[model samples]
Target: MKLWKSRSGVAAWLVASLVFVSACSGSGGGGKASGGAESPPASSAGSASQEKQSQEAAPADPLGKYDPPIEITTVRIVNDTYKYAEGDTIDNNVWTRSIQEKLGITVKNNWVVSGDAPGGQGEQKMNVSIASGDLPDFIPVNSRQLKQLVEADLLMDLTDVYEQYASPFTKEIMNQDGPNALASATFDGKLMAIPNTGSSMDGTFMIWVRSDWLQKLNLPEPKTMDDVFAISEAFTTRDPDGNGKPDTIGISLNKDLYGGYAGLEGFMNGFHAYPRQWIKDESGQLVFGSIQPEMKQALAKLQEMYKKGEIDREFGVKDQGKAAEFAAAGRVGMHFGQMWNPLWPLVDNKKNDGSAQWQSYPLVSVDDKTAQPRVNLAVGTYYAVLKKANNPEALLKIINLFVETGWGESTTPDNYAEHFTKDGVERHKYIPFQAWPARKNLDIHLHLLEAANTGDKSKLNPEEQDNERQISEYLSGKEGAELGWAYERVFGKDGSFKVVDKYVSDNLILPNEFYGAPTPTMVEKDATLQKMELEVFSKIIMGDPIDNFDKFVSDWKKLGGDAITAEVNEWHASK
Candidate 1:
């Protein structure tokens, strides 16, 4: 066994275990085919018949079940929100049972850990597994872990397996965002891992405003940054809620300035400045975005807003949940967030005050130039196999066939309802590996819109049928409207994803220039640099000198930011 001095070192070792085992110990049980017991032939005719039966018994289909059971060992991250059917567990559910019965494979969890557990204990356990060289047949890991494993040469090359075993639908789903999605998992011209693809649009930001407040104040919908400023100022000072108190805030912000909700990243995008991202300059060299001239302008505006009491005075201490209280209580009128914002704190606002009506709009630009929502590539997780595993291709075939059988075009409504969506149980959670099409949600919305327009549900898929009914109930203002309300906000005629579709069509998204694994300097000094950035930016937002922005740029460059930049550019150039 290899000893590691640190958790990252252990993680790197664990990642490379499969390769190490394959190189040292040779291939193992994963590749062998199990055969039935043969009987001695009594005559020539019997021998010929037995030979024909043997040929027929061989597993020929890509998704064909193993004649004898095959067991794969791994660990599981049990999501806190996952719901199970009565008497079902992580090891025994419709998903797991189906895999056993249909695929002739059993998944044995070496251990199970809570996804929401504190201190990242699950990841720490994984590191221990690596240091001991006691790795399972296969596992899913993040980009950083995957990178370490690749560097250590402890993973299998999955290029041929994927090409040979992946179903056509799976291939289409993985490639929807183009080569970058797959390129993230590719190292040195070899596909090192199977990328878990998610919708890039899910990360795109938008400006969500309370429509009822807009109507109360008689303000036109925000179409420009100036309009947004005017609305925020009016909401703050004019008592749009009619409580006759100066207790309202213009826009809600959180302690973490960059995230999916209550973040300033979207707000900065309005000014054509992307903070905490890597962007390309006019000369085509990648640079850190936080120190750009555009960022200084944005910081100045935020500082002005802070001094005018338009932003939360205690925002530096408030996290997303804490700052969300203002929105939930209807004390705030506008915030910059993502598509799902309406389903969350805004939903709480509606419940608290039925009069609160929120709507999503495309981000407004500061000038004539359109504001493009900054989106990083959504390839976060990867599935890699140990080289010693007999059938590394089995993972590919399993995911491909599982998706097709359970949720693809070939899926039947009856089977889907019975095995997958029953009683709100997330049956998909039981599958050891999970992947989704990049356009799954957007496609659902398009279908929902079509169904709404035509007033017909005959052509809708099973999931869409359920959504259509929920949206109809909400629009009709029936009992149990809250459930429908959330669905409508996400999938109805004026759903938040409508803007996502428009952005996709117009190509208005600014993807991060750097999506490769973390650079050496980044892995070493990124945390410190990030902390400094947040502190300086927070102080500036809370009334520090605007010139402090320049000082921050200087400090950031001196404190490892320059090294990180060089490393990122080097990676970019090599790619």
Candidate 2:
């Protein structure tokens, strides 16, 4: 049995009934892959063009000659299901140790656990610290938890810290990524945390139809919602795979709600019935999107599909992974997901049978509507930092390190690269995944990593050589391989670059008005509202009477949904 503590200072032990916690855990330039078209014929080089490109300098060092070094102990929470390299430990890894060595920083772990839940000893340790009022210098918390901490005044205002010390590169990213992200982390006009950035890279999600199946059936790819229906009809009626058994389904829905909502409702958006997560109605009152009349129409269409045997009947229990399995097995005709879906899940499925030919299609609105598919801009899921032990500037220092190391630069200088090579540390080791240098200077590193992975530098352009250097350096060390492996996984030969390219070329990004963290009113009711949302959504999707939706909406309003909206709107108005 194991005991865990909650934030309120209660000691709870884990019994056989409890689950175990595990160790804590790029987008790019490229041409699009053809639909059902085998690999686009490779281009033949006329002659290898070798020109060393001019490189940019590192951002000016921000912490100019501070007297004595300050030590800060930051407590980090990593995902439980993280697959660590063979010898990797929570205390040491390529990512964390690089900061310690390069910047004279020391990050001490108070406790660590896996999953969003702070389970077992990790939760217990955090609770004990809170009860004792001995919290660490910095705790990078989740959005929901951040709301609680803001009410408690346990966080430091980062506005002044950011203004004084933030590197130009990071500042530029803030502007490029949009102010809504900052708005999410600010409270009372003071920035509370450094918001994480996701490439507002538009069009990451698309409709994936089985190209081989489409060819077998001689059906055209869907350009609109109606086309989607037609294809699904054919996929279900005529055995597209020519298999003897009639086991094919037109579409497989995960019923996961959030991920699919954007795609499913995207069709409704074409009809001007935009079923947004948060929307304002005719009376200018903020309302939830799930209960909207528009959602009913969307559900009705899905219900029709379900009745027609077009949608998978077992969607309720099928997770994203399982849905991918059905698609790979050729039992499902279409699925909606981000562009990276193929190499991530489908490409891997080729292990079972190499002929699983899947491709992406931009499902344009059927009504000739120009309303581009709206994708959400992510602010900060993985973006967090540890506070310095006694010195308040420690957090700022770490941010500065992330910026100066490669924030504005194309690649680290050759001298620094050499230094990294000699020390057995990667020049890009301290470079956080979201930094500007990593994002903008990608062409350089692309050439480099590709050369190393495929062992052919002649194929790389001058810019790609930079990426190759960092990739090679990263793979040389015992610790560096963790980061190296992650990079390769994202952009390698079988990486997500191809699908990501297509997505970026299409879609519209809706920059939501990022509100501050949850307020006191939400403390008592947020959980109830969340539960209500899932219950109502599940019931409606599972063929509950349409009238039940009205009842659900009424119940939701009564159960803190209205209050939460009022609080959110009040904050929104202030912003």
Q: Report per-prediction Cα RMSD to one decimal.
A: 9.8, 13.5
Residue 565's lDDT within candidate 2 is 80
Candidate 2: lDDT of 533? 65
Per-residue CA lDDT of model 2 for 1-575, tens digit only, reads 00111111111111100201100001222111112111111112211010001001222233432233334565645443333345756666654565555555566766665544534454455546655766666665546556555666666666655654455556665655456667777767767777654444422345767777788888877777788888888889898767777899887676554453123544555444544356667876666666678666667777777778887787776655566567656678676654334333454444455455566665456577644444444444323332322434445555555444432233244433331222333333222323332133223334444565777776553224444454455457544233333334334453334344443445354433334555666768867776776666666667888677688778988887788788878876877
Evaluated with lDDT, which candidate comes out highest?
1
How high is each candidate's TM-score?
0.87, 0.70
Write down the worst ten-residue block by lDDT for model 2. 16-25
How well does model 1 score by local distance difference test?
0.72
Report lDDT per candidate.
0.72, 0.51
The residue pairs found clashing in candidate 1 are: 14-130, 16-154, 19-154, 30-390, 31-390
Residue by residue across 526-555, what tens digits does model 1's lDDT show?
A: 899989999999999888898998988999
Q: Count the backbone clashes (under 3 Å) in each candidate.
A: 5, 16
Which 10 consecutive residues of model 1 have the lowest summed lDDT? 20-29
